[model samples]
Target: MFTNTDSLLPRDDVVKFFEDAKTLLELRQDNNVEFWQNMDATALEIWLREDHPDKADTLNSRICLSALRELLSRHLAKMRCAAEWVHRIFEVSISELKSHPDYFILFSELCDDHPELLRDAYIHYGLAQAVQTLMARWYLQPKAEPLAGAKRALPHTFVKASDNEALARLLSRRWTSGDRFYADRDLLRPVVGDACTERKVLIFTRLKESENDSLSLAFDRARTVIEQGPRTSRLTETFADGLLRLPLTSSAGYLEHVRSRVAVLYLFDDRALFVEYPWNRSGTGHQRLAHAYSIGDKALPVQGTDYPVEQYDEVDTLFGWQQVYVPELPEWAAKALAGPSVHVPTSVRANS
Candidate 1:
């Protein structure tokens, strides 16, 4: 596998990032609740002044402003949108803005003043705007709704905008701008020659019901189905629309198991036959099923609905045939490993 190297940022810049992150992490650990609940800009400034004296003047100057911005923006994303860790992310942006406040101001204004503008915007705009507004308000306003106050604090929006433009005049940072190349079926199409098998077997496994043992069974059945080739057999149909529900966290675990199995399986034959199952279940399917199950009678989908009774039969559909790989380890076994009795390798494998 090719290792992705850092583009062109200086070693010093990267080193500073890790050092700052370490200090920030330590600060967070010490004042857990205060870190989230309250903004103590002055205290942060004082700490920066004393501890990171070399970077103090600059760090202290921006601490409160950045913290405030991060706090509010994260709160906004959480309250307004059920976004994940909206605050922590915004804090990072605020830090970036410390060196370039002007750009941050304009960016914040755009995101806050026009929430809908970044609907189609990529990660950069969304992340930038989310952070900028909060930081600008924290530094510039001493009262509530600081961004709103800043709107009037300046002689005009244009003047504030000019101040932002002036900040842009300072040190310019170079970032690599380009499109990301994701690995997909299309990318592999060329490498897969014409001699490849036209058939594709997509296993639909449910993580919820599958014990590690059950997963072994499922994989065995999947392989048998694959060996049978892509016929319009009952197994084929079952593999297509079968729904599997598991605990949300277990989904990643199941996928990792599947990926590792496939990686080992591929070593046997390099033939252009795609056999892995599709994990991308339709959100609509889940919603519809949830609605059906929530009904007063708890009846399964009947004649009227698109899902026929025969189609939804799980047992008749799954567990028909199979192989034995990593038999599902017992939950008790997992628990035992947590203690000293059992030993699991310390090396952690990243999920595919």
Candidate 2:
């Protein structure tokens, strides 16, 4: 069973992941918000990173709304004109041609127009992201620690156009480029960076995105907070989708990604809490609203939308985590393991 080995463990990363999850369960039992907040960081630094002492200067947000309206309107006109021009060439009309009129209509229409428009849409969405980002960043004073700015600042969403994979990946190429956290000069696990970033996507919506399925599911699952136990079944749907959407270039790469940024289902009775187990950050998804949820407690005093459905009992099961012991060994030879062989030892079997 111990075919593969890493310096950290006797078997391999696959086994090590579950062991770390078990540790998180224990931590959850013992502590409160502190444990989750500072999974790796020290107490003091987590404060600086999460709970900022100084608020940014008051934003002139009334202008931001007007600005967003003007900006979106301008872009919409551009897209509509482009759509009209292209469709007219083929003796067609974008408005006349019917779409399913579902959530992805925006994306679907963009795809029908031209591949270039898809590119523009992706850039267009990113530019819209930039608009909100710049507004927030404009007021932020330089941080004493530059990384703190990134770590402490609120999360932003990415837009997608599935046509150009190169362009799609370009946006995130440099994000996790470095591993070390500068605060108090701490070492960072580059693998954990993906987990950290994904966890911050608090404003999940079930808008039926044509972009990344994981983001859609993340928001979809987030809605479970509204009906705590009833949405338990969606876990299976989410897992199935994860399998379908895995960017599996190779078995080895997929396994490594799973091991490093492990998503664990902490079963605390009927309610299961999932940690860092959402969609690929680089996929096509409409990243809407920089601040989608109204600020509130675990009870979630949301004004209208039912996102951030309060706190959830994330622990997934009444019993400990289990594995069915994959019947076959991973073809990667050097990389699979079973805890203890079910059959008798070769010598014992022969003796029997």
Candidate 3:
């Protein structure tokens, strides 16, 4: 099978030796196998560094020799009848492999280059150890956080506001922006045209204690528009409250807020409109506001945003801050937010 050998070797000499060994294994018709018929350690060393200007170092020689010997052994194992040619190429016996100073390194490289070789228990252990060491070295490297400006286009529809006035203006704008078409008519009419069955409108929001009245007014206007529809049953709406406190300015707190807020929206499976009022403190101590909207199951931040959040711990009191009956919540989420032994408040259950 074809393989990229260049990725395995750091030096040209090592690469050449690996190429020759691979060629021997493939047994190409044009290749002169007879050249290795009487090959020995001294002859192999000369062949390994034939075109190189500098003399071969002891380490390179040993690495190449160890690689060739192991390849020959594997080849012989598969094609027992080729023992004569294998012995000629690998003058050193299998026992010599154990005593070779560089055998472990070579064997680990072989296992990495051809993972199928890991079917052998010894090769698997050597490969595991080698991989562990490499991972350890990688973990020691310093890493830096990505700049916020590097973010790509957001996946969901979002708008930002600088303060409470801006937030109120944004909500008013959303309410009237598309209401003209349904002004004289009905809002839910467009949603449930001919359906006589019961329909539900689910709403998710982050309620601020100071701006509750304005926010409630906005919600009432939205409901009024929906109630204009002609339906067999009264329009049912579910409003789930988000975190009472905003996240701290630190990256850790910001990420925790995001996870908890997102989880609230994820609990509702039916088609619902989720609105978020995220507030963060600026260096000047002014609160910045941002609103995000998404349809059911289509909302969470793009995969790129998840990387930064993963670096921090999840908020502990995720769902505990506010409790609402979400009978449709997936079993996993229910267990994660509230254990089996936890009691649900009567008022919260009734509202849910």
Give candidate 2's TM-score. 0.19
Q: Which of the predicted structures, 1 or 3, would earn the higher lDDT when compared with the native?
A: 1
The TM-score that candidate 3 achieves is 0.17
Q: Return the lDDT, model 2, position 25.
A: 30
Task: Quote the positional error of residue 251 for candidate 3 in Å.
Answer: 24
What's each prediction's clash count?
12, 11, 0
Score each candidate by Cα lDDT: 0.29, 0.26, 0.27
Highest lDDT model number: 1
Per residue, candidate 3 scores C-alpha lDDT tens digits across 152-225 of: 11112112222222222223322211111101001222222222111121223232223332222212111000
Model 1 agreement with the true structure over 62-163: per-residue lDDT tens digits: 543354434434433332231222333344444454324344345446556556535523433345543444444333334333343222111000011122
Residue lDDT tens for model 2, 23-77: 4333321111222221322221222223222411111234432333343344434
List where candidate 1 sits over 4 angstroms from the true fold.
Answer: 1-289, 295-338, 341-343, 346-351
The model with the greatest TM-score is: 1
lDDT of 1 at 13: 32
The list of candidate 2 runs beyond 4 A from truth reads: 1-58, 76-194, 199-236, 240-352
